[model samples]
Target: RRDTGVWDGRLGWGRLTHGRAADVLKNPAYAGAYAFGRAASSRKVRPDGTVVACVNRRPRDQWTVLIPDHHEGYVSWQQYLQIEAKLAANRTSTGARPPREGPPLCQGVIYCGSCGFPMSTGYRRADGTADYVCNRARSDAVTTPGCHSIAAAAVDAQVTRLLLAALTPEQVHLALAAADDLHHRHHRSHRGAELAVERARYEADRAERTFTQVEPENRLVARSLERRWEEKLAALAQAEAALADLAAARPVLPEPDRLHALAQDLPRLWDAPTTGAKDRKRLLRTLIADVTVRHVDHSRAHIGIRWHTGATDEVVCDRRTNRNPTQAVELVRSLLDTRSDAEIAGHLNALGLRTGKCRPFTVASIRHIRQQHAIGSKRNDPTGPGEITVPQAARILGVHEAAIYPWLRNGEMPARQDRHRRWCITWNPQTEDYWHNRVATSSHLKRTNPNYETGQAV
Candidate 1:
């Protein structure tokens, strides 16, 4: 016989029970009783018993049981495994697997060996057989060098084979060992150099501060010293920031187990989802320094892999490669200066440069480039050469053109009375040009030309 009751104890809501000693204390009974107490830790459970009694603590703080034999104990059961399994299942369903180890071998990853720019990836057939191509070949086949397209499937297969070959037991061990050694040496050297540089900068700053503090009270001297100190402080701050960034950027050396896991799972990396592939690419970037691809023919290409772990394990893969349009543009930009928007556009078109969206470069795109470089009318330099149309000014200044009448009435700006009663606003060309020149001048010009001479131009 057993009796059960709800017990509201100091701990929290609980269940109290009393039962026959033999029945309550039996192994099966004990197991069930213990499970009940454990569950009560997170819930409320009441048991009915006599000789042996059980009482679950309140607030689920502990699973306590009181025996008629004058013994009390706590019990718990494993529950986390089920929860973990459910959570893992949920994650998989939500596509939350870990990131891939490498970058996608597409437009952003594949680079031309000759031009050093990303090569575009495209499908040659509907069968999903893709190709890596250079912008020069697709757009300006006549002028661009090595405009040949390579099949993506073929290249991927070749690269996979090469990677497999490199992942041999002996090769992997050597690579892992080399990676460890290199990482250790790199970490030590980098830290030492960084510390030395920081110390030097700190000493220099202290010396400069001391000198400035002891300097005479001349205003000019004081101003110069202040400027020097400010410059020194800025430099010191920048250096320290750079050092911190480098320290943070330095990759941690993977342990043996992690390295072995990566080696074991290298093949699956290629088949991973886009995110997984990206992670694998990042890891590869950490381990391997460079990949150079050269086109041997329309169908065949050679890839050379350079490991950053101080080992020159050059594995060649056969694939097709193309040049990046952006890189080609950069190369052309580097070779010439003062190129007009039209000129640049023409050059790119002739040299086979196209937009990432697969469109030919328009005048707008050329203008965008000039704007980026702060050149010509597209320039944003407050003092740069540009045209300011009245309508544009009206829109920018959030005013009606008619409102400009007030400026003309006050002679704040030049104007002419129209045939009707209205006035037409006009800018003083000389004043405008003078202001432009003043803006373009260096600090020395401000010192030399202190006054604008109201009516006079620069």
Candidate 2:
């Protein structure tokens, strides 16, 4: 009989063998375990070679099992290729272009004629129109007085027109002729001076030689004469060397064609590029003599531009809405004054004047003004005698030394010093009297009552 019913219990299977199971399952662990059997039908024969049939039992059912073990995971070759492609793309993007170089000219070059300030540059309204603005005129803090802000475009246009007018054929010829004439005259005068100096030196050398010959026995006198002659000769050599150097350094006048080309192309060159193109400071110093900006109202200005030709020819342009010639001339005169830096600064400050940037007058600003004016002695120790030592004077004054230092250093204080290291502190006699009285009172208190406090002493 065959057992074909489903089995619910655990079941397992192993290799089956008919002839010697021990020989087929050599391992002891597999031999001891019973091999699960499957249901099957067996055929049996009759008395004369007949087959016999029998039913077999089914194998026992087994529960599903899970094994915990380490295994390697696989990635698609295509995904690896994509990752490499991304890395390469990133590197190519990063290596595209170089950084821009620094600007050729910076804000130090741009100047506002109206306010005498450096103009700042910026882009306008996200469009390509670049603008330069004066912060002083635009700021709320500048309520005292000044011109309104000017558009860079308008200023550039005005500058272009002015340049065109100034560099005209007639103007160019005049400038060239004037420059040539001045150069020649200067050369002649310089040569004459050189000859005079040489003649003077020769006469002095001859005189010294004559003196040495007459006083041959006088060793001291003879040595002095020889030294004088040597000094004179050295001076003459130095003068000649200097003259040679100056001649070598003299600028060769530009040819007519070069001047004409410059005149024609200057406007375009100035306009096409940004304001920071080339050495603008040197350019301005070379070309412009002075720029005078006069305010007609809050928003308008009249500019008078002067060139550096020997002749006094100037171009006047209305940069603002109104035109005022008289005011312009006054402004020009103020711009071209020959005064000490301090004097000029004080005058400007007193008049409530400000620089182009609308900042208060400073010592540096005054210095630049002085340099422009070419005023005062260039020699070291230009100060006259009798100036007081500032800190010492300040100590005596019972004030901060800085306050008095500026006064003394700038020649504001009339006090003088003597060889005894004593300061003859002098000022207006009336002011001196007040100080003297104060000193006297302080001294009296100090002497009579040693412990008395200053200002509290009776």
Candidate 3:
């Protein structure tokens, strides 16, 4: 289709149909090749014993007569073969799907580990996520009804991390080198355009001088000289326009420091909004042959990756937990009396825990989880006789209450939260001395009370 002449309404030709398009693509004559025996007719006997004539298309290799470069063609034979290959790959029945424009990274190369069959991709309407599923029973009658279905987010995240790890800084540097080479080539082209402009200017100047020196009395010769001069001036103008266009089209390359930073932070480039799923998939297919996924349990899965270099890798990934798993809810409930919502959220995040929605825990989310489970908030229960609240402790230590919070967080000061989510510290003499010395020696701590003494404030 590349070199084929365009059709116009004036020719009174009908529009191209799908069948006609396929026929043209499959024809070797369009690719400047000649062939014979493209199809063969044969007789087949039906179950009723009646003979039926059938025609079957033959493979290119099976053709009896074939010749390349037979005549001018719309496309080269190599381009035609590539198109055929692309068409073949696009067919789903071929067991090889081409890279699609979807967000699933392993759409074409993911397989079910249990049944060893190609997995199909499905999107969840609720979250718009691509999931890999293998309907083994539907595909094969002999297989069991149960099959594997895993969310693409977890698997794609793992595979993307691995792919980014494989692209070392060395590879990034090589890419930078390629970019520099491309810039050099662009610069050379711009220089060539400038040289062309310069040459044209020189020719025009010479033509103008020749025309000026011609005798006015020789009208015929002068007229010819003037026309030649005008042509040279037009050529000069055209060359100058081309040079201006080239200058405007030139791209601005990144600075060397930015390039170095990009090499160090290649993931930023990979995660850029401009980078699409198809690009990421292509990069993955370059190194990874195929990925086989098997769910081990409700919260875990086993991922097997076969690289193009024949090496293989296996890793276990924990699946996203339910929104309010019993374990997580129980943990939150247990920590409720001793910790506030913010503290609980921080603890969960430190433990690498996520909410049922596969999101990191926040204070609001933790509070929501508590409310959903009917867990009571911290109460204002009375403290023991020897224990005092945070303000009392701060007054005893001769420092602002805000100054004591960091010590409690880092466990530098021994304390506990009351039922009201307020810090309760024991006010013994030894404890007082310890905090007094801590505040005295701590440069980050400020003693705002000018009238209070330092030793226990008693």
Candidate 1 root-mean-square deviation in Å? 31.1
Least well predicted 10-residue stretch by lDDT in candidate 2 = 96-105
Go through the candidates in order and give each one's C-alpha lDDT.
0.53, 0.52, 0.82
- Per-model TM-score, in order, reads 0.33, 0.37, 0.52
lDDT of 1 at 402: 61
| Top candidate when judged by lDDT against the true structure | 3
| Candidate 3: tens digits of C-alpha lDDT, residues 253-357 | 678677667657778878999998888888789789999988888778899999987988899886552446666788898898777788888888888878777
Index of the highest-TM-score prediction = 3
Regions more than 4 Å wrong, model 2: 1-117, 137-142, 204-208, 211-216, 234-238, 245-249, 261-276, 279-285, 289-301, 309-458
On residues 303-419, what C-alpha lDDT tens digit does candidate 1 reach at each position?
A: 766666556544354452332355645744553344545656677778776764456776676555545554443222222134344443344333445644455577766555422
Ranking by TM-score: 3, 2, 1
Question: What is the alpha-carbon lDDT for the whole of candidate 1?
Answer: 0.53
Candidate 1, which ten residues in sequence have the lowest lDDT sum?
Answer: 69-78
The candidates, ranked best first by lDDT, are 3, 1, 2
